[model samples]
Target: MTELRIILFLIGVAVLGAIYYFGTRKKVDIEDELDFSEGEEDIVSVRPNDLPRKKSGLTVDEAHQAHEAENVQTQKDKIVTLFLHARDGQQFDWHLIQSAAEQVGLEFGQDNLYYRFKGFGNNKELIFMVANMLKPGIFQPDMRTTGLVLIMTLPGIMPALDMWDTMFPVGERIAEILGGKLTDENHHIFSRQRIASMREEMREFDHKHSIQ
Candidate 1:
């Protein structure tokens, strides 16, 4: 009887030990799996939507105005543009256009367009640029265009007002020579009022830059 009791006790202890071992091993394995899952999450890439965005406290119009002001500050000069167009139902003759440009002291050079320079040779300063109103913006022999575009940068080799003064007459001369009409950028007639307004703007620009 004693022997049987001892055997029973030993069997109970063995069963309890087995249960404890398996339970502890299972718990360790579950913890290791959880740690591995966390490590994978750390290496995963974050989605763009999850990233933070900056909140600018400016309204759309205010932001646009600020951007324009910044551009004006950083840009070397302000651009003034004018157009020369043929009469309705008419196109400019390529040969006449070339002659008119040359007559106005414009040289056909860079970008296959014409340029007016302030001085001679390498010391020359570009006053303004001219381009064909058509696509590719180049003057080619035997090619007709409805118009030409003149672009001048203000506060260039001279004061803004002075540059405008120089460029306007050149446009007028080209118009006269080509039988074309001088127009504003909007293709409206270059009226006296518009000229006055543009001169005033140039004056303001010159004053702002402290240029004589």
Candidate 2:
């Protein structure tokens, strides 16, 4: 009985030692495989002249301007827009648009197609955008317009939300000055009822996703 006990104890020790050895070996193998997989990527070779080059040698301001140009459409998508429409049979005057924008502290950006404005409010500098409201199906270099639209937007790097108080008054003021009527996305005349509804929507959206 004593001899049998000794033999069983030795067999148990051997089994445990085998398990530990194989476990450690497998762990080392896995780590090595991971390290190999994560090694630096191989560089593809090209002729010296054929190597990819920047489209242009841009200065700092030029580079920043290029970046902004690329993000124009992206920024446009994230905005709250309000339109000011000219009376029937009247198109917005480009010169008037420029003058009104300047009076309201907006600068002439890019082509006369759009105007840019910024102000410090609510602990941040808010960006305001103004652009032409062209007639439907029109895409020309200098297309005639119904009036202009004000877009409360942020840069591509910033978040988008409804900024009612900040934008509504400005739109109203501009419309008043330009002799145009305020309208919504569907051409509904902007009324107090519409403003209240928009306020509620903005409040609900803010609740779900904080603008900051």
Estimate the Cα RMSD of every predicted model relative to the unseen true structure.
34.1, 26.9
| Reference-based lDDT, each prediction | 0.61, 0.47
- What is candidate 2's lDDT per residue for 45-135, written digit by digit as tens? 2121221112123445654554455355342333456767788777666667666766776755332434333344323233454555431
Tens digit per residue, CA lDDT, model 1, 1-212: 32222222222222222222222323233322211111112212222122111112334464455446435544544657777878776888889998998788899874466878788975666677776654445578898877777876555678888889988999999999988899876667878899999899998998988943
Task: Judging by TM-score against the true structure, name the best candidate.
Answer: 1
Clashing pairs for predicted structure model 1, backbone only: none
Which regions of candidate 2 fall more than 4 Å away from where they truly are?
Answer: 1-78, 113-126, 135-144, 154-162
How many clashes show up in model 1? 0
Lowest-lDDT window of 10 residues in candidate 2? 31-40
The candidate that achieves the highest lDDT relative to the unseen native structure: 1
* Candidate 2, pairs of clashing residues: none
State every prediction's TM-score relative to the real structure. 0.63, 0.51
